[model samples]
Structure formats: C-alpha cells, structure tokens
Target chain A: MSDELYDDLILDHYESPYHRGRLESASCEHTELNPLCGDRVQLQLQIDEERRIQQAYFEGEGCAISQAAASILCEHIEGRTLGEVEAFDARQMLDLLQVRLTATRQRCGLLGFKVLKTLAYAYDGTAGTSA
Target chain B: MENIRSDFPILGRPLADGTPLVYLDSGSSAQKPQVVIDALVECYQTYYANAHRGVYQFGVQIDEALEGARERIAAMLGAAEVEEVVFTSGTTMSINLVAQAWARMVLEEGDEVLVNEMEHHANLVPWQQVVRQTGAVLKHIPLTDDGHLDLDQLQNCLGPRTKLIAVTGMSNVLGTINPIGRLVEAAATVGARVLVDGAQSVPHAAINVQDPAIDFLAFSGHKLYGPSGIGVLYGRRELLEMMDPFLCGGNMISEVGLTESTWADLPAKFEAGTLPVAEAIALGTAVDYVTDIGFEQIGRIERALLVEAQTRLQEIPDLVIHGPDVDHKGAIISFTDPRVHPHDMAELLKRKGVALRAGHHCAMPLHARLGVVATTRVSLAVYNTSADIDVLIEAIHYARKVLRRD
Candidate 1:
C-alpha cells in the first residue's frame, strides 16, 4: 500500500463518486478521451440566469485518477461561476488532487478538468444545448 | 532455463525501487541476451562499413557477416533460399511491403482479401490500405465465443475470387495459437495465397514457411530477443520478382538514371537505403541464441509456466482471463480484474517492481471485440521463472487491496 496513486481518499471518491450520472437538460457538456489508455470523461454543467454552475455531473470510464478527477472537479464547480470554472488551471487541478503523479500519468489526472475548461471556455451554449 | 537466465544481463538487474524485477512484457519486446548485445558491439568494432557499396577489407567482412546471418536465419525459417529474406524496420514495415508491393500489384477490382479480428493491427490495417487502394473487398472470419477464429466461416470467406488470406500465427492479446497449417491447406484449395504474421508465434513455436508453403511471413526481431528496428519479411522469390520495391534508393536499384531505373534482384529490391547494420547482425545472434536453447526445452518450460499462471490466476474470484484454454494458448496471459482496472493494477504492481503490459497492447480491435477497454498482459519468455509468477500473484493481490473496497 506504499503506492501513493491508490491512497484512501482517491479510492473512496472513485468507489462512491459524486454526481456520477448524466445531467439532463445540462447547459453545456464536453467529453475528453485519453485514447492512449481508453479513458473517457464527460463533464456536464447546468447554468442558472446568474451564469453560475447550478448543477454539475460527470460520466466516465477508465483509470481511477481520471474518474476521481471527474467527481472532484464536478463537486468543486457545483456552485461556482462559469468564469471561475474557466479560470481553473492544470496546477489548481493537481492541487485539488493533493497527490503526486508522474508526467506520463498527469494526463489521467487532468482529463476531466480539460472537459470542464473546454465547455466553460466557449460558454455560448443555450438552454439544453448539451447533447 | 538456469543457463538461459544467465545469458540475459538485464534479467539479473534490480528495479530502481530496490524491488527484485519481475519482467512480464516480453510479448511487446523480449530482453536481449549478452550474445545478441555482444554481436551489436562486434559489428561496429570489427566489421563496420557501408554495405553492398564498398570493396575494401571491412566492407567485404561486413558483407560476409550480414549474408551469413541471412543464410542461417533462412535455414531457421525453412526457406528454400537465403535471398527470400528481406530485412525491414519491423513487423509493421514487413506487412506494408507485402501490401504495397505485392497486393497492390496483384489485386483486381473485385478481389477479396480475407482477414480475421484476432489479427494485430499490424497485420490487419495494411491489408485494409491495399484493398481500399485496389477496390478489393476486405472480409473477416468471425471469431468463436472462446476467441478462436471460426474455421467454418473460412469456407464461406474463401473462394476463387479471394486473392489472399492474411492471418496471425498467434493472437497477441488472447494468447490463442491459430491453426495455421490447416488454414493454409484450406486456402490452397481456394487458390488464395496466405500471409502469416509471425510476430508472436515465431518465438514460441516451431513453424515451417515451406511445409505450409505460405506465400509470405512477417515478424520482428525485438520480440524474438533481438534488437529493435529490425524485422523480416520472407516472401516467395517468384512473388517478390513480380512486385516493385516498397522503398527505392541507392541500395536497391540495378541501374538508375534521371528518367528511368531498373530494380535490383529479389531481397535487395525490397530493402532500400542503408539497413540497420548493427541491429541486423545482432538479430542473427538472437536467432542463434534461441536455436542453441532449442524450441523443445523452450516449449516445455513455457507450457508449464502457462499452466501454473492460469491455474493461479483463476483462483482470484474477481479476475477474468481472456483467451482460449491453456491447451490452445501460448505463454501470454491477458486478463481483466473487475475489482481493479488494468492501469491502476499495473501502476501498483510497478511499485512492487513487477513489469507488465497494459492498455490495448496495440490490439484495440481485439479489445473492442472482447468488450474491454484495456487489459493487463503477462507475457513470459525463457528467462522468466516460476518465482516471477509468485511475485506477480503477490503484487496483483497487493494491487487489488489498494484499489478495491476489500
């Protein structure tokens, strides 16, 4: 159990992930695939009239890090503004992970974050635009 | 096997974390024996020169060494002539040579090229490229439930209009040893030439290029304990003569002019530009090293290891092995554990200093067919021992505990 990759926190979140389902009538959604290892993370967000992320959920398949990242990111942005979600960067995502990952596996940790950043970066979708 | 282990220096090296190394990725690339390593050094130190172009001392000696290696390798493959062996970068290049040079030349608009799902992409994609280029229909032999190629479907797939059949001697992912001899016999009845991708099977079993009388065979050196960047494409001489060169330059032309050029003879015609000099020589040494150990002893030891691994792995209630029974399989084992995904398990196992192959193992189509995104592969070679398997089982259990609720 010396491997930091499977610490109790990551495994717990992976086992009972938060908001791990389709977000029906989501404002916007984006999916990122790590073709190298077949990891796919789909992040969906619902925006209110105030432009805040009213709801967030994720659907993913693959490594624990990618899936766990999806849960962590979705929960982190549940009530945050679209601007704050767009402002989230790779370093902050790793800071949220609070674990060490080698350069090769950093992609796994960042897959879900990429989806969130991509969707919020555009931010032009209308009501129920996510398909 | 004791003697075999000593021949590979890396087998004794410990991992950086001070865990005793248990390498199980030889299906992707086998470890090099000291003999092969020495041959690589010897090529430059004693016999280094531009091949087929110079007439000086080192040139002649290098030429002799290179051709001598070819003769021995040809004999090992049961090839009728040494010139039938054309060295390329690796298995992918070999298949490309046949597809671009041979298939493109022969295939008519409606000709059928038969393949199966079990083939590695190296064997499958090249045929796909050629068929699209020549309007040949690419058909597949559906796999059985247990992952063997459906030979009964072979009857429906092959006909007089079928120009070629591309098959793998062994499945890289499922460890299924295909019935190449029977397949070749059936292909002959329909007048379809057969190309066997020997990237996995050549290292594990005894095969005859002549007895089955296969039209082409392709394999890589690194997978057979030789250096990387070198592969062989053994084609029938008459067929090689009918096709044009895949790559053209100084080393592969009979005569070249500003406007016109004539190609060189059989093997050299396909091999363009300067070859991988040191790697080519070392591949010969690898062939010799395995020859000295003998396929009989290799097979016996590998069979025992496979049986032991399969038996041990099956004991884990959550683990599911993907392949045929041990009787029809090779030493390779690919499996998925529902409790722990392959990537997580592989990472945790690496912490314990046991190496394995994860991801699709360059066989994504096979993974798609099996309905698995990825798997963990433990591929054994002569140097691997039962102790390695013990470490593997222990590490796997350790990995599961780390990733699973239990």
Candidate 2:
C-alpha cells in the first residue's frame, strides 16, 4: 500500500513538478495551509473569456503526498472549464491519487484539490456557500 | 535497564502487523509501567470514592491517597512544603494557572515577561495571552546558531519591569538543556520571578525546587511515565498564598455568600473541584519508580544512548541535526534531510515499527528560525535501548534510499 502511494508516478511528479510557479496574469489565486504540519499550497489560474482554465500553476512546500498531489492536480485541471473544476471534490481527488490514505494523509493529498476548488468557487462568485 | 523495560508491558507487545515496536516518541508521552497501570485499576475497582467529600471509610481512604500523592510529588520536586505543590490537568494547565492566577495578579501595564525562542507553545502562548491582557511587553531570549539560549542577552533582557522569566528547562525539539539555576540568578538581579517549564526536564533529571531564586516549576505526569490528566505546579509558599484562586468553586471556598465569597487555604485554594484521584495516585507511584532507579543512573544510561544515537544519526548523508552538541543535550534528537520531508520520513519509519514524532513539535517559531517547515524527532525514555536507536537509524536509511530514488 505504501509502495503504491509513493509509486514512480507520484515520486516523479514530486521530484520534478509541472506548472510549479506563479502565473504572471492569473485570473484567480488561492492559498491554503495545513496548520498541523505547516504544509502550504498556493494555486493560480488563468481563465479564458469562456470561463475555461487556460493555464494552472502552483507553489508550495509539503510532504510528497501533498506536493505531488498539487502537481497532479495542476496537470489534471489545465484547459478544463470552471464548471468541471468546481465539480471536483475530495473523493474525486483521492480517486485521482489512486491509493488508500489514512484520514490525516487524505487531508494532505487533497490540499491542492481544495485550493483549486476554492479558486473555481471564487471565480464563480459562490465562495463560502458550500462545505 | 532491561529489567526497567520489563516493567512496561506495552514495550513487549508487537505492532498490529506483527512487527516489533520501537517506541521513541517519549518526548510527547511515555509508556506506562505495569505498576502505574495496576495502581489505577486497583483504585477504580476497590475503594473508589470522590476525594475530600465523604466521611465514609472509602472517602477517607481516597482523601488520604490524594494527599499522599501530593506529598510524594512535593518530595520528588524537593519542595519546601507539600502545600507548595498544586495538582493540575497537565503542564499546559499548570502554566495557564500561573499565567492567569499569578502573572495576571502581579503584572501591570509596561511590565515585561521574558521567554526564550526554544520554548514549547505551552510555555510561550500563555505568556503572550497574559501580556495581551495586561498591556505588558513580551520579550524572548534568542537562540544561538547551535540551539543554546543566548545567555549573553540575559542581562540586557532583564530590567525593573521584568516581572517574570518563563523558560523551558529542556527543549523538546533541540534537546538543549538550559541552566535554570543561572537563569534564576539572572532574573533575581531585577527581582523578576522565574517559572521553569519542566515538562521535558523533570522526567529525565532530578530537580530541586527549594532554591530561593526559583519561583515556580511545572511538569506533566504523562511525560514522566504516569497517567495523563495529572500534573504538578510547585510555587513558592508565599507566592501561592498571596495569589488569587484560578478557579473558584465548592472545594476552594472558605465562605460563600450569594454575591461574594472567601477562598480556601493554600493548596485547596487553587484546587477548585474534584481532582483526578486515580491519576494522581498512579503519578505518585511513578515518582517512586523513578526515585528507586535514581537520576544519576538514569542520566548515565541516557547520556550514553544519546551520544551513540547522535553519532549514528550524523552518519546519514545530508542529514542536519538541529541542536547543541550531544554532551549539552538531553535524550532527544531532531534532524532534517533535504531528500525526505519529515512527515514522509515519519510515515515510513512507522511502517518499519519505529514510532517517531514529526513536524514543528509545537515550536513553529523555532522551526522558522531554523529555516525548515518540519523535522523528525526521536526522543528517548528509560525503556529505549541502543537497539531502538539502531532500528531508528536503519529505518532512516531505508526511508532516504526510497525517497531519493530518481
């Protein structure tokens, strides 16, 4: 189980993250931090006139589960519509990771998803209306 | 030491997956010995009653046990009087008691409360809150690059308005043992009181609080190999008498009239309600257990283990230990490796049956000062042997190899 969680895919993403920087012309940006272990994530999005995510980038520091999840999330969300990204939830994020995680690690794995969802909500002007 | 380990049944048990457990997170909490466990069970099964309430035989016996625990704890601390020791829920509660009851009473606007950057949150946050309430300024004695307190700044930090100096006797993260005696002497120059947060020290060293320079000492039982929810706060007798009661209720009152009430005597004045009787008694037994072994022998064994652990930990490539030299540190070793995050290392070590603590260890400021988000910590207790250290080193090596894979 641990091997699957830290597989070559996840390690590769963690070692050489994709879209790991600030977006100079970001349409929306959001950041979140896990106070328990001091893990933090920032997601910046550049949305087109059609409300589609043209580009996604992230910057953060955390364990492999979180940092790799952020990298995977950035790769998954680029070019997707705001509606589609807004539909992404914790369960979907875990399924994307494709591994079992303890409740605590689940939070770590979903941090990027959370930041991206928040950015989508803010873009849609429906932030703080859902759980 | 092997016999001592035998006294703790949990040390002999295997992990859920049938791996032999190597418990090393004693800085968070220690494993209970069989005697402490038995004492708790016996108290609940037989002669169980609310202390200081009933006149029946059971109540009287329970009351005696409570007071006996107090006396034993006082003796262990080398306190001048039993009344000087107050029972609290834990170290956090003890520090809050002094912060609210003593510091709030004495501190005025513009007063200063000196602390250090290496303190755990329990010792640091309470003072911050107190200063916020009283308009007093809170100052910290910075740490040197090697993690020892910058004692040269002590003289400058103290002044007429310096009301208190709250410091940890030992650092839970860096394992640096501060010289409380010297701190007390420095604080005394300005008539400032010293509160030694002994949460990490009392369990590993023998402390004598009878010195006139010292004002208060606080420690929790769980860290001392006893039950949780039991802790001791030793305040100077005069200071305790002069301080107002923190929590006022039935047991802490001498007289009560609808709108106004008088408080009880020295110790009872602070103990407001029903105490944790069973935990206190078990903590008394824990004190006896440590006393029987003596700190001299415990210190010798722990020092040797610490030296070996430090040596082995230093061998790991890119591993940076964050603390003073082993000779000046206690039985804790915190380190960070650039290849592996502390949380990842901790998760990997747990799978290998090595229980270590990771993250800021409730010292975020210290972590920031050290320029890292988190670090893995291996804190030893009396039950931890060289074998456990070897296991920890092996697990670290395995984790590094797995994490650094291209």
Candidate 3:
C-alpha cells in the first residue's frame, strides 16, 4: 500500500526536513538530478581534518520520498566519517525510511545516497556498496 | 464513446491491485484499438517477411499490404504524392532525418533557425544541432503569457537568413494548437521552410501539408492509435529530391559502386535497412480506423472531455493548470498542486490505476519558461469519456488526501 511509503515518519521528515539549507564553508559539495523524474538535489558536506562529516545539508525540489530521504540521510551521516557514509548502501537508505517503496519510488528514496555515491565515484572514497 | 472505448482492450484491463485502468497518458502513447492489434497479429501470422528484400509469396502480399497502407496514410495527410510519405522509426527519427539530410545541406554560417520553447526536445534539439554545426543561429519566438506563440514579434524574428521555422502544430506540454498556417506564412515571407512537429497535432486535429505548403511534417504512429516504431515524415517532393539521404544501407541506394553509391528515389531513398514490417503494415489499419471515425467526431469527443476536465480541475483549490485555458489549448491539461508534488500525485493516482505523466513531458525548456520544475499531465483521446474524467477527479482527490497535509 502507498500508506507504507507515506508513513507518519516519512511524512514528518518531509513536512520538516532536517539539515536542509546551505552549508557555508563546506569542504565537499555536489549537485545531482534524478534524470528519470527531474528531481534536483544539491548536497553540501563539511568534513573535518579527521575525515569526519562535521555537517551535512541538502537542498532539493521533488517528492516526499526524495525530500524525506535526504533529511534522514543527512542526519544519519552528520557525525559519521566519510568511510561510514560510503559504506552505507542503498538497502540502508530504504530501511532508514522504514518503508518499502515501489520501483520508481525507490529512485526518489535514494536521491541523497546517489549524490553520496557520486562523491565516492569521484575517487573521494572507495564505496563498498553500489548505491 | 462506449463503442469506441471497447475497441481498445486495455481500457477494460484492471491493474494487479484490481483497479480499472483510467488512462490519461495518451499524450505519452495512446492505447491501441483492437483493429490495429488484429492487423499487427495478422501480418505476423500470415505474411511476415523482410520488406523489399524477398520475391517469394510472402514478400508480394506484404509489399502490397505495406504500399496500400502507405497510400491510404498519404491520402489522409492530403499529400500530393504517395512517395512524399516516408516511413520512419518514429517522429524522432523523422525529424532527425530532415535535420541531418536537408538542414545540413541547406544551412550556412550566419543562417537562422527560428523555434519556440514549447517544442518537444525532439524538434528543438535537432535544429540546435543544425545551428551548432553550421554556425547558424537558433532563435526563439517568445511565448505569450497565455502559452501561445507571440506572432506580433514574428516579423522582427524573421529575416533573409532565417532558413527554417521549426514549430509544433500543438505543444506536447502546453497543448496550445499553434497557428501553423500563420507560421508557414511568416516563414514564406523570409523565404524560409517550415517543419511542423505533428506528433501531437495529427492525432487530434486535421492537417493538409499541401494547403499550408509545409516543407516537412513529422509525427508518430503510436500517438495516432497505431502500433509503435512506425512514423511518417512528409517532405515536399522538390525538397526531398534535392536533399541527401540520411541513412545508408541496402534499401536506400539506387546503385552501389566500388567507391561511390547513389541514393534511391524518394521514399526508398530515405528508408535504409529492413523496416519494422509488421508495425508499418498495422499502422495502415490504425489510419483506416481513425479515417472511418473522421476528425470531426474525434475533435468533438476530445473537446468535450477537455472542457469537462478543465472545469472540474478548476474547482479544486491550490491546483494550477500549467497551460492556457481550455479555449486556446487542445485536450491536454497539465497542472501542479502546491500541496502535493507531481511525482507523488502520479504515483498515488496510479494506485487507483489513473496513469498520467508527471514531469516536464520532454519539454524541459518549456518547464523552465513556465517557471516550474514539473507538472502532472492529463491528455484526452477520442475513446475517453466523462466517466474517465470523473475517475481521474476522484483519484486526484484520493492522491491529495494521501499526499497533502489536510
């Protein structure tokens, strides 16, 4: 049922997204578009000398799944090291949402992780999981 | 409408969740009628042979069938010669043919190709390529606030260097039925050729290339209640004769030399390699089906549906229809609800089996012009009815309830 995807938790995050503004003095930044549906996501992360993600923020325009997932993923990775963020696979992203999305919605739910994957793919880190 | 609706079997089909298919995505691709399906089946079952390659029994029957289909389609388009209607993979290929073969040959540095943002990428991108390669400039005729083209500035846009005016007969996104005749006239004033992207127009409206003197027309069969992978590119005889062939292979050549190969005559000159044999033959049946019903009836049915859809959609608050009012547009209605994202609307609406397109509808530039990222699209066809709109409205309400704060 769609209710599973539109659960209160996801909706809560969508209505009030976390870490969803510009990050000044960002060490890493990337913008990606889910070309399949035209969702725009820009990720800005502040990493410390220890390679720990000091701050994570995202700004985007898209569906609830996309917005909500970005909120959750940013919060989840705020204090984590870059290695931990790269280790976070697509499965964890969907599980983090606590919902099983239909195939199309899966793309929406994974927009943030895709941006992360791009950072990993850019030789910033060795991404253990194919996001 | 019931009789016509029954001709398309997919309408009767229910999704896995047991919801009836309330298809509003005809603008993407229309559901095929039984007649078209039957023709496709019959061709494959009875005589499925490589086109223009065989001399056997199957070849003769298929050739006759294919040619008969082509002739009927040509007549339907009011084309002067049957040879003018060249079979293409789809509208995309048809437009690309002209872009590569004709535009590349004619355009020079400092030449201009006038176009508008409402045109699907299929039309705009090809001309952009033509301009980029030849150092020709691509210009836009600014769109009206109501989504129509601003014809007032056309004279200023037109000049001696304007080689072609690439415009859509109807916008795939805005649903605005452009005045092709006026555009064609304006192009003529500048000694420019006009290529009408008829992918959306030919299915809903009647057009005659001869009367308008349209230099090139491109449209898809799938949108016209026909099988996919078959489309038509109608070029003026004089223009086609002078242009180079786009694709080269076994069928498109007149004679092969050790170092040089001459192109075949019109029609065959463009069709290279083996064709989509069954789909092309079935497209004949699709044209016949539409012809027997006639454009007058098709227009009446679609206009009524459009009016009903527009009125109902207007009653809902916070929903902004992305195009002009129904009076100025075709049966397409694109809208965005501030309370719900279009992707969520489309996804939730599908739970009730209402299939609509949600995105820029392949007109990304138009979306940018509309000052929106995406809008949900609902397009009507001849087979659609008031009940289908009712279902769509109810589904929209359901989607809103699911996705919105209320």
Candidate 4:
C-alpha cells in the first residue's frame, strides 16, 4: 500500500503540476481547504458560450496526494462540459489517481474533485469567485 | 533506569506490518507502562465502587485509595495541603475551571488577561472566551525570534488592570521552557496572579508549587505516562476556597434548598459528580513511577537523545528546525523541510513504524508566528532511546528520497 501510494506517476505529477496557475478570465472559481492538514486547492474554470470548459487551472499547497490529484484532475476537466464534471464521482477520482488510499488520505485524493464539482454546481457563468 | 523500555509493554510490540514500533509522539500522550495498566485493571476487576459516598467495605477501600492518590499528587507538586490538588478531567477542563470560577468572579470589564503568543490553544482559547464573557481585554506577550517569551515586554503589559497572567511552562511545539520564576515575580510586583500551564513542562521537568510566586498550575496525567481522563489543578488553598464552584452536582454541594444552595469545601467544590477513579489511581502510580526514576536521571538521558537528534537532523539539507537551540529546549523537536510537506512526511514515516505528530500541533498562532502553516514534530518520552532516534534519522532520509524530485 505504501509503495503504490507514492508511485512514480504520482511523484512526477506532484513535482511538476499541470495547469498550475489561476485563469484571470475564469467564469467561476472555487477554492477549498482541508483544515486538518492545511491542504488548499483553488480551481478556476473558463466556460465558453456552449458552457464547455475552455480552460481549467489550479494552484495551492498540500501533500503529494493532494497536489498530484489536483494536477490529474486539471488534465481531465479541461475541454469537458460543466455537466460532465458535475457527474464525476469519488470512485472515478480514486480510479484516476490509481492508488489505494486509507480513509484519512481519501479526503486528500478527492479535494480537487470536490472543489471542481462545487464550482460546477455554483457556477452560473457569472464570472465570480468563492473560497 | 537502564532497561526502562521493558516496563512499557506497548514498546515491545510491532506494527501491523511487523515493523518495530517507534513511538515518538509522547507530547500528545505518552505510552502507558504495564504498572499503570495493571492498576487500572485492578480497580475494575477487584474493588470497583463509588468513592466518597459509599458506606460498604468496597466503598471505604475505594474512598481511601482516592485520598491516597490525592496525597501522592500533592506531594509530587510539593503542595502545602492535599486539598490544593483538585482532580479534573484533563488540562483543558482544569483551565476552563479556573477561567469560569476564578476569573469570572474577580475580573471586571476593564481588567486584563495576559497570555503569550506561544501558548497552546488549550491555554489560549479558554482565556479568550473568559475575557469575552467578562468584558475584560485579552492581551498576549509576543515571542522573540527564537520562540522564547519576550519578558522585557512584560513590565509594559502588566498594569493595574492586569488581573491574571496565564503562561505555558514549556511550549508543546518549540519545547522552550519559560522562566516561570521570572514571570511569577513580574506578576507579583503588579499584584496580578499567575497560572502556569504545565501540560508540557510537568511531565519532563520537576516543579514545586511551594514557591510563593505561583498561584495556580494545571497539568494532564496522560502526558505524565498515566491513563487519560485524569488531570490535576493545583491552586493556592485560599483562592480555591474563595472561588465559586465551576460545576455543581451530587458531590460538590453541601446543602441545597428550594431556592438556595451551599457549595462543598476545598477540592470538592470544583470536582462535581463521580470522578475518574481508576484513572486517578493509575495517575498516582505514574507519579510514583516517575519519582522513582527521578527527573535528574530522566533529564540526563533525554538531553543526550535530543542533542544527538538535533545534530543528525541539522545535517539534512533544506530542513529547518524551529525554536531555540538544543541547550534551551525540551525533548520535543519540530522541523520543516521545503521539499516535503509535513503531512506527506508524517505519513511516510508512519509506514516505517516511526510515529510522529504533524500539523500545527495545536499551536496555530505560534506556527503563524514562525511563518509556516505546519511542521512535523517528534516528541520524546522516557521509554524512547537513542536507537529510536537513529531509526527516525533513517526514516527522514527515506522520506526525502521518496518525496523530493531534484
């Protein structure tokens, strides 16, 4: 469990996170913090006229599990519709990470997914932000 | 003293994956010794009964044991009277008792409650809430760059309205022991009372409440290698008598009429309902156990381990140890590395069967003062040896390799 949890893929993603910045022209942005570990994730989405995600970016601080999970989530959410992201489940996020997490680490693995889903729900394409 | 680890049964066990368990989070709570465990089992298995109220033989025996435990704790603290030692649930409850019963009664709207920025939330939050309720102002004495209290500012912080000064005897995060004697003297000159939070100090150091400067002290038994759910609040007898009861119930009241009630005397006035009898008795045994080992010997062994740990940890590149140098610190070491997040480091270390604490360590304000959101802390106990420190160093290297990309 330990070796698989810190596999090479996770380590690579954590070291060089993809889309690791805020989108100034984001239609809606949402930030969430795991108070227990002080893990933070700020996810921004630039939705187009068709309500598809034109761009997705994030920036935050946390453990490897959380940072890598956010980076993996950014790659999956970009170019997807807001409705598609809202339908994403915790199991799919766990499957994306390709690691077995204990109950405590599961929160870290899903922090990005939770934040994106929250933005999807609250986003009315009004160009606003909530933390 | 040579084979103290043998006395602690948990230290002999292994983790689920068969890794030798290296328990290092003693500042949170020390692993219990077999004698303390046996004392708890003896209470329930043989003579479990309600204490202080029972008339039967079992009750009488339990009552006598409770008083005996009180006497042992009083002697440990060097209290003039056993009544000064009031058993509470833990340190948080003890401080809450003082805040509610003492501060609420004496403090006016303009009075000041002085605390330091380095205090654990257990000591800080209670005073915050108390001052809010009493309309008194809550102020803090800032910390120096090395994490020691800024005592030079104490004279300015103390004034006529300074009614109480609450300070931690030793910081849980930095392990810096404050000069309680100096703080007490400063408070005395201004005619203000002092309450020393000994949750971190009393377990690792020897304290004598017989000093005229100290007015109140609170500590938890779990940190002293005893069972949880038991703590001691040593107050000056006069203050304990004058303050109103924090909790009122069966044992804490002398008489109750339709519209009036009279509280019980001394310790009972604060202790309400049934006490944690088994835990208290085990705590007494723990006090005796530590006394038998003697703080002088404990301090020597722990200081050696701490110096060795500091020397090895300092060798790690990019790792920053917080607080004063080893000479002024206790058995706790808190550090941060830029390459590895504290949570990640702690989780990886746990897999290697090296248990440590990470996060703000309940000292968020102090962490903020240090300019870091969190840190990984390895706090030592009597059962821990230099061998355990070696394991920790090796684990840190493994963590760096696994976590750092460059």
Per-residue CA lDDT of candidate 1, range B1-406, in tens?
7778888999898877677888999998999999999999988888799788789999888888888888878988999999999998999999999999899999999999999988898999899999999999999999987999988888988888898999999899899998888888988898889999999999988777999899999999999999999989999999998999889887889999999999999789988899997888889988898888888888999999999998999998879999899999999999999878888888888987888988998888889899999999999998888998999999899888777745
Give lDDT tens digits, candidate 3, residues B147-233. 999989898899999999999999998899999889888888889999999999999988899888899999999999999999999
Superposition error at A7 for model 4 (Å): 1.4
The TM-score that candidate 3 achieves is 0.97
In candidate 2, stretches whose alpha carbon ends up further than 4 angstroms from where it belongs are: A124-131
DockQ of each: 0.65, 0.54, 0.51, 0.52
State the lDDT at B397 in candidate 1: 90
lDDT digits (tens) for residues A33-105 of candidate 4? 8888888988888889788999889999888999999999999888899788878889999999998999999
True contacts kept of each: 0.68, 0.61, 0.61, 0.55
Candidate 1 residue B119 C-alpha distance from true site, Å: 1.5
lDDT string for model 2 (A27-94, tens) is 77888998888889998888887888889899999999999999999999898998998777788888
Candidate 2 vs candidate 3: which has greater lDDT?
A: 2
Q: Which portions of model 4 show Cα errors greater than 4 Å? A: A129-131
- Please write out the lDDT profile of model 2 over residues B14-92, one tens digit for every residue: 9999999999999999999999999899999998899889999999999998899889999988898999999999999
Residue clash pairs of candidate 3 = none
Model 4 interface CAPRI class: medium
Ranking of all candidate structures by their DockQ, best first: 1, 2, 4, 3
